[model samples]
Target chain A: MLAMRELSVGFAGGLALRRATLSVARGERLGVAGESGSGKTMLGLACLGMLPEVAVVTGSVRFDGGELVGAAERDLRRLRGQRIAMVFQEPLSALNPLRRVGELIAEPLRLHRGLSRAAALDRACALLSEVGLPDPASRLRQYPHEMSGGQRQRVTIALALACDPDLLIADEPTTALDVQVAAHILALLRALSESRRMALILISHDLRAIAAVTDRLAVLYGGDIIEEGPTADVLAAPRHPYTQGLIAARPTLSARRDRNAPLPTIPGTVPALAHLPPGCRFAGRCPVELPVCRSTRPAGNPACHRGGP
Target chain B: MLLSVEQVHRSYRMPRRRMFRAPPVIAAVQGLSLTVAQGEVLGIVGESGSGKSTLARLVMGFERPDQGRVLLNGQEAHRLPAAARRQTQMVFQDPSDSLDPRRSIGWSITEPLLAMGLRAAERHARAADLLARVGLAPADMHRYPHEFSGGQRQRIAIARAISPDPALLVADEPVAALDVSVQAQVLNLLLELNLTLGLAMLFISHDLAVVASIADRIAVMHHGRIIETGPTARIVSAPAHPYTQALFAAA
Candidate 1:
């Protein structure tokens, strides 16, 4: 129900996202995986018309046959909470300290759905229960500071779900959480998407979390989508060198191997956006880069000169 | 043993919830004990509020244990003199926070050396040498912390930690802030340093897979206690404690 064709976001620093083409169907789960400065978050922000003031956007963003690019602020505002909702990494920052949990959730419902104060509060309590928060009635009266990190995250999820959005954009939603809590949140997101028929875009630096929750994966590097395919297929057999490097670099618990050996790591760090190579973004770091890779950009699904490694 | 903690106990005072009531004390660490052999890497895995950072502080002698003893090289760690305490150094989670933004990378790396009463020429030479050792250009030492990327800044932090030629390194989530590729590089650097310099390390992290990759021994911490401790392979292959098993399962 959503599509982006050659969408790019640039500022004074340079292009943060470049000619990105992507789509997400209703109830589809798409994972955007990248490190810092990789532009994964930018993709999500662009979809919601939430880019910074200085940001210069180009190309098309179509949602349900309507163009979102250059759309009126009034139009985008109406669609934001009602149709496309977001959950951030830090739940505490997303929640207001002065307000009670019930009010936080109900405000979105009242604003978007125009429900009565009493009715909206009732829906908020149900949303809390649906998102697996215990004792929804008591929790409604509690403030954000009184809740733990995981509980706060669940409340934020409840707030997002209060409007019954068609699309949910969770940007590293579990990165700030503990391992067990993170796992729980990932599972909750997956379950909510499936049950509500809500499309999901799970953006994270963690490949394991993405692999566990997402159906399709798009690997981003230096403002470009280096690889995009089925999550299972891409993980099992990564075609791009960057994808291969990322998978190899991760320390695995289930895998059996020598402990004394150093993990395989990609040499060098990601270059600054302005200093990025003219050709392929991955050219300078790719293990098997052809000469042409340094001068000419590779245009394909894997976005590599040496495909299917 | 390079380091030992003998039944260490620590608690903190929490504000009173009710008027006219005595403030309650929460146990941060309780009767916890462990030992690290020379050149060994002991990984402490725990979630937030599980007392991992508290343990690190106790080891670094930043906070004295309310009860029990922390020993480094058979001496009370907290009682060690200023010069002697330099033998144990720390690398914190965020390099950007640990590093001074205004100072040159060389200045930050050589601060410990300066405190040791080293001459200017000697400190400069050592800083340049240490930079190369951590896989950075020696010439880049003059640049400020902002000039370097996150991974490079971390390398600078490592270089600073090892500048005093410490016998034991306490790294608290050193690679947690780094990317996967960069995380692996830093982990390998720590292992390499441990091997080449015989630097015993207490590596603490919430990431099970990361600790598994580097630690010779793994200690699972829960509710201010060591629930499980064993060789890395055994801990990874078959954890005996239910908490440890749950932690691994979550990972």
Candidate 2:
């Protein structure tokens, strides 16, 4: 199992993330959804021990009996490809431009497993096939620029799975992709997790994408985990007013919008880090907001008014 | 018609020539035609390279069509006088990059008005009113783009687009940047504006479910041509084109 406790971090005067506590069971997919500055990316990178020097992390992170928050740099480096793998947001930028596709995919296996060249090559091709890449062998020598966006993303997935790690954390994995290609890649990931029984952390802003993939969902706002519950329940009837507001505002289920309809708009923007509200972070924009909302933070509850067990 | 794109055919001149005999061409858009009635939304849906964006540019008058015509309110859109064409506006996909970071949100929102020679006091009041209409408070006019979240920044973009009360609004994948819930909010805003202003819209997106929401009529484009077009409910429930069916199936 992978879990976090009170994980908090921030960027130069901007609170990127805050008070985040989430977990993923061995065979489940946990989705982390939030906006640009909401700290979703910081939390993911912090887990990989890759946070920028400016980011100050304060919290405990546990994965499969090991701790990540305070682990030494050298030890964390060893743990990365062997125990956990991260598929970055941008495929082409994350990958080495000069390296051939095959070699790049096999890099983790070569480093962590100390496999021979032939063995690494064989494993790379298998991993490529697993990501649903066509002509895996024929594209071994292709450069990153030579491949399409979908292909490059597939190769990146192959690289992350080089070691078949227990935990896979993907941050905004398909942000740049269109729906069809994004869906195909998502299905590929699901298949991979089912086959390997690996824990998956899918971080994205798109609820539908996460809804189509995740087993449980956590809504991140103003750097805090406002709500966490089963995906369907949370989606169908969100408990937290903020979650409800998000639903009313999205176009995903707004198939009934006609000329006479009222467009649901969430009032106000998220408060900045330097200006994190004294009460609920979302109180400023909450339509059902009460006086207490501006004076005190609400406790995180699995049972909120909108959707709860 | 607020905007009209008729039989637009844009072909790129491929690089390299043996002897400059004739340049090879890559057809980006071929025989494409689209119209947006005032306050009516026409959704353009397709995958990358389907030429949906090219269609937007042609309608925006940023790119001249290689063939056919683009008329805005019964006149040439791009070729109209600067003051006349300013009646049209656009809201881009990514608000972060689309907005000018160096300037405050107030400046960016009122800049267009300033360029059009609106009095500073009037433009300021108009900007504030526009902000409130899009769900932001009038007070937020002083904040920079970096101060708001993705969803809120998008609101700012919407306000900027509608500040001039342009007859036509072209939004290219407006909600694509947002989270599912946030996307719902933005869509709701657009839908409301569509009702209130009766503003004609060209809503371009790759997500079928999104187009299924606010679009009055849906056009499915593949390669450079629109393979199918119909009302939202009919097109979604009973897509005629094989590609449209496949798209729905994949989604």
Candidate 3:
């Protein structure tokens, strides 16, 4: 159970995430989809109290009736591995090259659960098996570099599940993997969340990845959550102009498109953070922007002037 | 055919793990053959370790295949002189890495022209013209790569790739590093270039949907071999191979 009320993350350049309110219930899978610089990653980091030192975070983040915003580093550290574990996009960098896979998974268990080395390692082996890794016993002794990208990602997932976290924040978890491997990872995440009753926040720029695993979706644009609804509903009939543009932009297998025709693309690139308009972040690039959109902020779940595209 | 790769085979030796053991060789490309006609967009779809990039290198004459031949304009690509090799230009995945951040965009775009012995005046004129062609302002020529966004930098990369007026363009995941919305823009630019310039492209990507959007023909690669090759529509509609079917399902 987590609730974020008007949370904003800002740097010297500008606010990267602005007045965003979101919540996730137990065992819920929430997908945060956005382009680069859309602040999807920042929102995930803010939940774990893992923002950069220079980031100025504002508003409230409540988890399990505990306020995480402005909590002490020690308090955050205690909750991190035990309650809210994260899986990053780059699995290789997340894992230590020098450490064996078993040790990596076992350390978190030992630290958080106070298990003996042998007991922790045994639990680690079980976790490896739980995440569907083959030969869990043998995989424990191998280094991160010894495994393939997909295997390394599985190991990382095992490490995250070591302490049986209540929430898992996977930021572009499958971004670096191949298509088939990516599908496997997404399936694994969905299965894990359902079986373990863990809340998952899957952040990615790819709409297809989001569409595959998440039931609820939040579309971020230039640091703001412009649209939030059922993933299927939002994808099928997006109300916001920016959301429409994003859905249209993605190449789809279902569509029989003319090969010579150009894809439907948003008119302009995302403006620099410092140069973003005070109103809607998608204003300048939006296809049907009213004059008021340029100077005034639009509000609502879809966050638009004339909704229902 | 504008370009043909004939039974190409390439391999690399793996590091030996034990003493007194011969290092094992890893086959990256194995007896792979394909052809791209003039102005045709040939999409190569494959996962990592599938040797798609190795094929690009072989086609570009950057590396000689251990066996078979890579022929460009009916000539051995690896044996072609530097001047002749200029007919092929490449656009890489990450524009930031491919571009020199310190250099002005104009200078980088015109570097290929320099290699072809173009005078300074003509190079500048061509660079300005190329920037406009890619949908960037002519004034952006003076701006450095760091000044632009990822999408804009890719537009600059495209401008550079086309400056030489190459007969064939080898784009290895050109839009992979870009955002979804921005990826569409770049893909559109590539499509426009293909239509207007009649530039044959070796479009390589892991995204089946993206390949489907741009390519006239699609080749599905697995374990360093072409498992399926057909018209793009046919490949997407009714894939013959199970691997291709699985790939489509995954995408």
Whole-model Cα lDDT per candidate? 0.93, 0.82, 0.93
User: Residues A1-309, candidate 2, lDDT per residue (tens digit)?
Assistant: 888888878677866666678888897888887776567887788778788877788888887778888788999988898878988778989889999998897777888899998899998888888888888887877889898888889988888888878889999888888778888888888888888998888988877778888888988887778888898988898888877777766654325556466556666555667777766777677777678778776775632222233
Lowest lDDT 10-residue stretch of candidate 2 chain A: A300-309
Instruction: After the best TM-score superposition of candidate 1, give how far the Cα of residue B212 lies from its true spot, in angstroms.
Output: 0.5
Q: Candidate 2's residue-wise lDDT over B116-174, tens digit each?
A: 78998998898888888988889988889887889889988888888777888899989
Model 2 global lDDT (CA atoms, 0 to 1): 0.82
lDDT of 1 by residue, A1-309 (tens): 999999999989888999999999999999999999899989999889888878999999998888998999999998898899999999999999999999999998888889999999899999999999989998889999999999999999998888889999999999999999999999999999999999999999999899889999999999999899999999999999899999999998877567567789999999898888877898778889899998987888899877655
What DockQ do you compute for every candidate structure?
A: 0.81, 0.52, 0.83
Write one digit per residue (lDDT tens) for candidate 3, span B186-243.
Answer: 9999999999999999999999999999999999999999999999989989999999
Count backbone clashes in candidate 1: 0
Deviation (Å) of A10 in candidate 3 = 1.2
lDDT of 1 by residue, B109-171 (tens): 999988889999999999889999999988988999999889999999999999999999999
Which CAPRI level is candidate 2?
medium
> Which segments of candidate 3 are over 4 A away from where they belong?
none
